[model samples]
Target chain A: MSAVIEIEGLRKTFRSVRHGKRVAVDGFDLLVEAGQIHGFLGPNGSGKTTTLRALLGLVRADGGRMTVLGEPSPELLPRVAGRVGAIVESPQFFGNFTGRRTLRLLARAGGVSISRVDEALELVGLRDRGDDRVKGYSLGMKQRLAVASALLKDPRLLILDEPANGLDPAGIREMRDLMRSLAAAGVTVLVSSHILGEIQLICDHVTIISRGRRVAAGRVDEVLAGHDRHEFLVRVAEPERAVDLLHEAELTAAVEGTALVVSGVTDPTVISRVLGEQGLWVGELTPLRPDLESVFLELTGAGEHPSVPRQVDDSALPAGADDAAVIDLDVRGVDA
Target chain B: MNLVRAELERLSARRFVQLMVVLLALAFAVTAATTLAGSHRPSEAELSSARTQAAEALQGMEATHQQCLARQNSMTPPGETDDFYATDCSEFDPIRQDRLPIAADYLPGVFSFEQQARPLLYFLIAFLVLFGFLVGASYIGADLNSGGVVNLLLWRPRRLTVLGTKLGTLLGTVLALAVGASLVYLATFWVIGQTAGLGGRPGDDFWRSLGAIHGRGLVLVLLATALGFAIATLGRHTSAALGAAAAYTVVWELGARLVLEIVDARRPDRLMLSSHIAAWLNGKVRFWDNQLCTSSSGTDPCSGFYSLTWGPSLVVLLVITGGLTVAAFAVFRRRDLL
Candidate 1:
């Protein structure tokens, strides 16, 4: 696939007389492929918005070779910006106007027809209440309205910073589906979110950053791979016999009160055959897969782990999903 | 057309603007009612009282001046005095050249409750302050704070037009208010002519003369409005912009004038826009018989009242307002509102 948004050797910093100076983005490189639902994931203030702003020419970059569509970011902003749409940070709006009126104004300014406003509003599920003043809108409704405004131009590349802000569970679900369909229709979406699990579910690729640098990038599964450590628990009525047989096969086994903790052996077949020939019946063989959270914590310097544990069910996905999911994404795969 | 309509809707929907519009209309109505309410019957008792006061005051002033002149003349040699000076005491005196504005003569005829609160012109100035706070904030400062301007900028993908349209909306609203105020002023005077006996008074003249007062009033309104808007754009903080405007008009302008007066320095009033417009509005004040004409300060840079005709001063005001507005738009278009 051709590249839609490209950044190479990008750098930026902020200087204020009162607060001193801070480096936001340091020599960052990113390439979002055409028609992919790309996820740019990072902890708060990790330069996601800064990079996106630089790409949109909303903020000047200290140094970079950045391009959107085809031309360089600075020289091609006007020419390429029409084909690109963005909703940076919070949804900006004129409080007095209705959702429909605001969308219509944006459409006219974008040189898009007024009819497109209705279509955009409907896509965002704001059709019913489009006539009400934006001031009366709930936070979620306002965010959706902003999404509608961004969609007015039918852009090929959509850059969104925390687009799902203020959305409830159901709204988030609908937004996820909408993003899928947009990508299917060949729209390139670059979404940034702190919610890593959501990115795993909806994005084709993800780039993770920490302290103004890329920590991990590529297909979600690949970023989680090698870190997907699993061990099988062997149980039998003759526990001592099983341990003796396992030890003879050069497996380091630890006693976890009742069950022996076998170190480094993942496949059930190898353990079953070696112990089965010794006339021992092993009752349980369980394989554990390390989740995205563990991998993320290990990769990024945000040392604290997420409190919620993941019940990873590899069986629910298709047979080849684990391997296929790992290799074929942008940003961080070894192949990439 | 759609964008322009949206701009109007957004401005009208603003809370501050809606409050201001309602308050402004009410303020105008209240002022008009009070100014036109008093009867011009000229009762016999009041007339008798005025005649007694004038006679007594004039007699007192005459006695004092006579005593002083007699003392001076007795000491003076006759050959030093010219026949002309004794014959015409008032001729070519610089004080005689200081003609008071005609607006002062009709000021008492204004007769509204607000008008009676003297220096109603200051209320008009205050309106500009409130108007600027509402309109300037909604257009740019609010947009930045909400990130609404960034969204609009993203959608349109043309920064310049968005900034231009924001300003265009402000200008359009100001013009509409001006025209409305003028119509109200005309209707007030018409009522006064038919009812308050202004026809017998000296101020009943060409409608154009009254219009010139409204015209100058309109300029004052736009200048304050535009200056506030420009400051708001630069500061990007509504409260800060308001503070800056207040500092310039109240602290800077008022302070300078006060210091100059204390020191008895030359040309203090020229630094003030209000004084210049005052000269322009003088002829139209219902209480003041005519515009004040002074030899000092208004027309010249150093003179506090160097005389500038209505047309020139108005043109100067427009240019200043226009220049500031354009500069404001330019800065706003380039900034990253986020």
Candidate 2:
């Protein structure tokens, strides 16, 4: 597979008189291959939008290298721009223009056939409301119109930033299906969102950014597996005795309520034999596999601890850590 | 070319531009109605009586001129030369027959295209110039403010091309509208002249001069539109261009004029932008400057009249338009969109 989008050492800083200088993105790298639905996951203000802006040339990058569809970004991005569809942010349209008029103008500007306007509108489920002015449309309808605008060129690479924003649950599902269909049709998709569950479901490859740096990136299962400790929840008569017995067998074990959570188990027979001989009687044993959300929280420093199950809000971030301030650890084993 | 077409469509779609077009049509209708109400053709008897009175007045003026010329040497002072008392006799030259001060002429018997059209054309030009500026400003201003430019750039990806096409579309549309409006204005006034009043047919020179004035007016419209577009593009909002215009009027036109008047500056109109614009539109303008007097005594105080011609006016207007346009393009090209 060929690389459709690439960024290395990308750096950007915003400056204002009142706020002085603040780094928005620092040394961020991303690689998206052809025909892959790559999820770009990050916390809020984690430089996801800044990286996308720099890649699309909406904003200037202070330093770094970026490319889309094999062309150097910004300078050479125009060369391949026709083949790339992007929605940098939630773009606002002229209030008076109808959705159809807006898409037709974009099609004209992109040198695409005007006939595609109808098709694009249909694809985004905005065919019925295409003649209505944009201002009257709801936020979800505007999002659909934006998607229609992006699809005007029938581009091979679609870069959407927070595409699911302002979308209802059904609209989000439709967007997911649309992206999946696009990927299945040989178009590479780079979708950035903070919705981890959606990313986990729709994306085969994932790149998680925290605090302007890539913390982990690979297949969704592999990234989750890297943070997986291979633990098990055991239900026994005596949870305390089972934990001590598991500890004597050189296994890490903890007692929680009425269950014994044991880690580093090579086989299930060891737990049955060890606990059965002690008359503890293992009633049930279940493997506790890691999910994307837990891995995401742990890597993003939004979790209390890996062993303790907690919500994202339970962890307290350090002061001034809103700007990502994440741990930079790369879990390799990703296919090039 | 596609980008230009897109921009043209977008510009025409703006409600403000449409409102301006409606206003222009209203102005034309009002002008025609007012002009019709103020003019009428003279009756044969009224014409004869006016001609007789004009002839008598001309005879009396010639008699007065002859008497002055005859007494010129006798009225000379003791030490002064005879020529000093010889006033310019040409000032007493008989008025042309066409320009005779007949009651009908003064009471709007004939609609002289040469005389009436200049002011009307000036009114048309002012209206169209205002229309161009506001339309141009709102056209680009709404785009930048609404992220339409960013959306266009995503498709086109050539920032310069996008900005340039928008500007080109604005100028071309403004020029076309101005020319069309001027034609309609002239044709309507001509029809009025032929229908309800004496149609004084002007010669080729009058047509040529009128054409030239319209041409200058069209250029002024284009320049004003381009300036408005450029300023809005730079500031990324329509209010930016409007604010700048207001600031210039308050600070330069009013405040500086008052300050210059207080200081009794020499040729203060030289630094005034309104003066340059007036000179550009009217060919040339003459302003009085008290500072140019060589002798300030009561006996013989000299007055100075300075003319600001078309050359300097064209240069000043072009430099301002070109400089702002280039700056706008440069900033749009290099600066971050967000």
Interface RMSD of each: 6.7, 7.2
TM-score for chain A of every candidate model?
0.80, 0.88
RMSD after CA superposition, every candidate: 9.0, 5.9
For candidate 2, write residues B83-171 as lDDT tens digits.
43234454455653234454444444566555678888999999988888888888889888788888988988888988888888888
- For model 2, residues A87-121, the per-residue Cα lDDT tens digits are 97799988888999999888887889999999999
Q: Return the lDDT, model 2, position B172.
A: 90
Instruction: Show model 1 residue runs off by greater than 4 Å.
Output: A94-96, A226-268, A273-284, A304-336, B40-130, B200-209, B249-334
Residues B1-338, candidate 1: write the lDDT tens digits.
65576667667767778788788788878866665665463445655565566566556555555554664467545434444334233333324433322322433433322222224544654575467555775556776556666666665556667767777787788778757764664566556545653334333343454455556666676676676677667777666576876787787588876876787655566556665566555631112111232443332322112354555556666776678778787877556444
What CAPRI-style quality would you assign to candidate 1? acceptable
In terms of DockQ, the best-performing candidate is: 2
DockQ (CA atoms), all models: 0.28, 0.41
